[model samples]
Target: MASIQDEIKQTRPFPSPSAEAVVALMRTADMVRRSVASVVEPAGITPQQYNVLRILRGAGEAGLPTLEIAERMIEETPGITRLLDRLESKGLVTRVRCDKDRRRVWCRITTQGLELLRQLDAPLQKADEAALQALGNHDLEQLIELLDKARDVYRRIS
Candidate 1:
């Protein structure tokens, strides 16, 4: 394993342990994102689109409101409307205005979206597994717990 300093070719050390950890986390996240993008982008959709499709698929027949979908995204994105527009144009999803709440829009995964996710399912799983292949089961669990603990700072503020 390469040190963060070596991987980034940093001549100067991070000022603090927190700074080093933050940089390392961001770097690792970018690597994982690229790995996922390799799988999903070749299929014609970015990872974010894949995320939205999966969220809607999990919502089932009743579906979920547009805002709710945004809340559920793995990566927080401000342009969810544009994301939906792209997915809608691709014929992968549909949006219907709620009858009772004129301002609320319900989004649902189309049959095509479901089918696309189905095709990518196995490959996505493999990609995810390969990303963490270096970690044993116990280490993986500890990493998850540590990540959760790290996020407690944001949770407290929010």
Candidate 2:
């Protein structure tokens, strides 16, 4: 297997291990995202849309406020209104104004949306498993711990 430096065809060594690790993390993330996209593309929904659906599913029958959905997203997405609009147009989600709080809009996944997610559940699991198959169980756990620690560093500094 080619190392990250070789894969990127960088002739010179990275300035530091931190820089190299950052580049490797980014490249690996993008590769995994692309793999996930390939799986979801056939279902006619982008990965972002699928993310919203799953979030709504977790929210249950009461649903969640628009802002709450945005907060719960795995990545910060600009123009959430547009994303919601697309999902609404596809009839996968419903947006309703909160009766008590007129300013807030509550979003819920439809039965169709639930069914779509159900269909995707197995395939998504398979894709995730395949993406991490190179790592043994212990290595995967350690990687998760290290990644979480790395993210926490930013959180603490910020």
Q: How well does candidate 2 score on lDDT at residue 133? A: 92
lDDT tens digits, residue span 25-139, model 2: 9999998999899888899999999999999999999899888888888889876888999999999999999999999999999999999999999999999989989999999
**Per-residue lDDT of 1-158 in model 1, one digit per residue for the tens?**
67985757666678678999999999999999999999999899999999999999999998899989999998898999999999999999999999999999999999999999999999999999999999999999999999999988887997
Give candidate 1 misplaced runs (Cα > 4 Å): 1-12
Candidate 1, overall lDDT?
A: 0.95
lDDT of 2: 0.92
Candidate 1: residue 123 lDDT (0-100): 100
Local error of candidate 2 at 48, Å? 0.7
Clashing pairs in 2: none
What is the TM-score (0 to 1) of candidate 2? Answer: 0.91
**Reference-based TM-score of each model:** 0.91, 0.91
Q: Listing every candidate in turn, what is its Cα RMSD in Å to the true structure after a full C-alpha superposition?
A: 5.7, 5.7
